[model samples]
Target chain A: MTLLLAVKALTQENRDFLAQYDIDVVTPDTVTDDQLSEVVISYAWDNTIGNKILSLPNTKLKWIQAQSAGVDYLPLPLLAKRGITVTNASGLKALPIAQTVLGYLLYFARGLNVYATRTHWEPFTDQYLISELPVLVFGTGRIGQQIAHHIKAFGGKVYGVNTSGRPVAGFDETFPITDYQAGLAKAQVVVDGLPGTKNTENFFDDHFFAQFNQLFLFINIGRGTTLNQSALLEAIDDSRVKYAALDVTTPEPLPHDHPLFERPQILLTQHTSWGENINAGRVGGLFRLFEKNVPSFMKDQTFIQNVVDLNKGY
Target chain B: MTLLLAVKALTQENRDFLAQYDIDVVTPDTVTDDQLSEVVISYAWDNTIGNKILSLPNTKLKWIQAQSAGVDYLPLPLLAKRGITVTNASGLKALPIAQTVLGYLLYFARGLNVYATRTHWEPFTDQYLISELPVLVFGTGRIGQQIAHHIKAFGGKVYGVNTSGRPVAGFDETFPITDYQAGLAKAQVVVDGLPGTKNTENFFDDHFFAQFNQLFLFINIGRGTTLNQSALLEAIDDSRVKYAALDVTTPEPLPHDHPLFERPQILLTQHTSWGENINAGRVGGLFRLFEKNVPSFMKDQTFIQNVVDLNKGY
Candidate 1:
């Protein structure tokens, strides 16, 4: 039987549903090198195993379903060259990721980040509500839209930034990337949800943060390379930025001795914003997308959603 | 002139507004014992000055505008006997308090409570979304309703517990305090927003925590006396309760070495949920309520809002 390597753990329901199709399933760890020729599809791509499967002499890998929204780490050029189709899990994680963005804002707003470390009870007077401050969200994509939605739910004003500066749902105002700085002075909370791309590299540098007329809170849940860490550190040091919550940093698994880890004002969540309720029977959005794509791919090499352009690498 | 003791700091706007009234304003620190007889109204009650003013041989204190909703700390009987009209600052703090309650849930849900203490990058899979959990709010008053509203905005279900269980505004389901256990098994997040009353004293005890069919998150932003500290500790020790956030505790300022302060699972916020946006010249709800009452108070011995019933002690 033709094989499908399910790189991630599958729920019983997924297994039962896939069983109805004419394909044999094998996990990354369980799939053998000899079976590579039979493996026509891969579910939830893994870097090392993906490269190995592609490198096999008689490999028949035709398509890959990526587990994350960003395919920046995937060998997109190589996949494009080999004519291998790639589909991503984009909107699936927007809800949890957006929820985490609000969580980060509250951590700084309610003074939980400071109070979390205390051993004694001391009332802090610096606490504020989300409604009292305005939030500026850069990149009004699925993730940014969800963030804006939750912020609005808290009675907060949301200013969204996108390529065209077109109005998006849940945002009070929208600005293009070139003009986002115009809204900075009025924003007390700034968030970056821009995807990883050549144009976005080092986008939030010193010049970007210097436009804020008042001290503001910063949160970044987007690609790490888009931000300049030194500039953020300087902003925090000068008290221009009160506190920052980062889910993603320049390097994954930031070095234990990294200065970011030493700063009391910066909180590192280690890119785990997307890790919510998936462990329970809630079966993630990725799997649901995979299930929908399975029948189409099996029949005519097409997908129902999230087909990524390998050349753009998103 | 009849004096009004502005115990708390008054904004310039508030001072200007009070100037238009007939009563002359004086702070507790600025007032003399001889002036006690002239002090007819008090804005924002203070424990120390309240006792002193009431004890004075020839004091003329008539009405007091309490800064907090709870009058448990005040000698209600004495105020009642002295014909003191008491008005409270209720509903004003619902937004911030509810926001803080959600912050506590996120602190645990996003694993910030665990990650805040870590120096290294580690991905925790135990994280869950607020939407996945069902929250049970023990009081469906202003604070409780707001909490239910925010939780519902996140797409979570809310079950409210009140005296009659006759259905509050924002709750998906309602249960009387006597039959709250009927819904406890379905609740993954249980909140205490009940007031401090003789019937509610030590309401959350060993039997209360034991009713949960599964591990659940606990949050108490209500009166401390309503929850039993030892019972909560035992719940944490047994792992029956996942984590807890406490804003109010048994003693206002718990001793530095209290066992509750030492638990990694228990988060204490030092009862500062009400301290939000008030500092930013938003002019607290208390001041607005005071302003509305000032005109009526000067015209006649009456209040426009929040007149507390001394016998009920709410």
Candidate 2:
């Protein structure tokens, strides 16, 4: 079978791993129209190259593997129509993203950010004990569950919110999205881990933020489109949201003049949550996950892990 | 029996609690020369008024309960010569300070401080996993042990340095100050939790910092005098120390013009590590420790907790 590798550059180890399979690997520059017709699988770095290959007429692509967890950029309807099985690197980003979430929580709890911006010695009285703060995480997927696990390890009570909220492990309580008002009211910190989808778009608007009675810290490590930026700014102004740490913003490389950059209460992290140590063996994690599922896909066009539902948009 | 209360102001609850005792509680303004002669016990907020009370001739002070953990400012020689029992609020600051240590650790591990200072979106590459970083903490006393406990809870390996190399409950490995080279070499993050003393003063000087072969972050939550400011700045300049987080600096409220203020690699917290949530009931933690020991001291001239050795100077 033939496969297309559209990542930046595959490590020699990854290349060697693919060499073991009886497959012809080709890159976008090298693949001809005839070669594209023979491509049975594609390992995509992003939707840009993936869409180009998909647009080729009479392509024989059977499966598409996304390097990133979020598949919002993918042409889901077209892929579903073409009967292409799509898998994503979901659990691979869990640990690093979870660590990032903890970093934001502890940043606010210890009041380090406030003191970092100060020029004089003034005691900050707004610190909270991480062990006592109640956290409400929006999504119970791999990233959200991992965030909850870390928070729970630190003695923070975690409440998970999902569509069905069918009691996920590592959460003290789980509430369905429709009934999360009580959870939202009690949470001292709210974490947005929801992926970008039709259902999740603008999920945290003014109406949603108005549900909070007490001042709360909001952290968004998920897709930025899932949150309403204007509403978040308003919440910060009204003191409904005490602070915000946004790793992902609506537009990446947010325009230099974006007002969020000027807000001291908001920390924009430039979507660096997935930047784990290069020496920590994380570079191979996604490839390993792909390798594990390859056998299942080869046997019967079935994915053993992280298969995205085209209609659900995750 | 008479007890001099030289704190700024007593909470109504504290005053009511003191009222239950047979001791005559007098504030600094209320206590006169005659009353000084009757002052057999004292709960001091700092050395300013406590030293004055002790200097008075024909004074009857026998025991001093310091509200702060660090008693370096206390006249140790006079207290030791006079045979006055000295107890301090050592363990009281442990939780808050430990939380602060975790704040610094997570801050660097997640690059929040770097992002906080940035005006644009640029990914920071120096992030590390807290669970994988080896931490070396100086002075395994109440504060150091508490810092180790929190680090251990987060799966970080903690190496503690003490005078005797005696095993501490929370540390994975314990080393004496005489043999800390190996620990220093392995440490990715070095935390100074040592108190100010003749032996520890300027202990982390040029030679001590030169032992680090790899890039490391240094955190000072301990007394500022224990660290050599010049050497710390030099280390940061040469890139031997990648980052420095100082809660206490030499001559703090470090003049705004100090060179350390200009370096982006350093984070001066203005000594806010002890800032805990006022609503978290920390106001009573130290007083509660004092109350638990008060009855025993009154009945038998025996101290129950945190009795400081004036000769050692912690």
Best DockQ goes to which candidate?
A: 1
Name model 2 segments beyond 4 Å from true: A2-8, B2-21
List ranges where model 1 is wrong by over 4 Å: A1-3, A15-24, A29-34, A56-59, A210-215, A278-284, A295-299, B1-3, B11-21, B29-34, B56-59, B212-214, B278-284, B294-300
Candidate 1 whole-model C-alpha lDDT, 0 to 1: 0.84
Q: How many clashing pairs per prediction, in order?
A: 0, 0
RMSD of each: 2.6, 2.2
Model 1 lDDT per residue over B156-261, tens place: 9899998888888888899987898876767899999988888889999999888754566899998999999999998998888979999999897999999998
Could you give candidate 2's fraction of true interface contacts? 0.60
Candidate with the greatest TM-score versus the true structure: 2
Give the per-residue lDDT digits (tens) of candidate 2, residues A1-314: 55756454557777777777766577777767677677787776556656666788877888887878988878889889999888888988888788888888878888888877776556566777777678999999999988887777666799999998799999999999999886876788999998999888999999987876555589999899989999999889888888999999979889888989988989888988876677536657777878887767777778777898988887
Fraction of the real A/B interface contacts present in each candidate?
0.83, 0.60
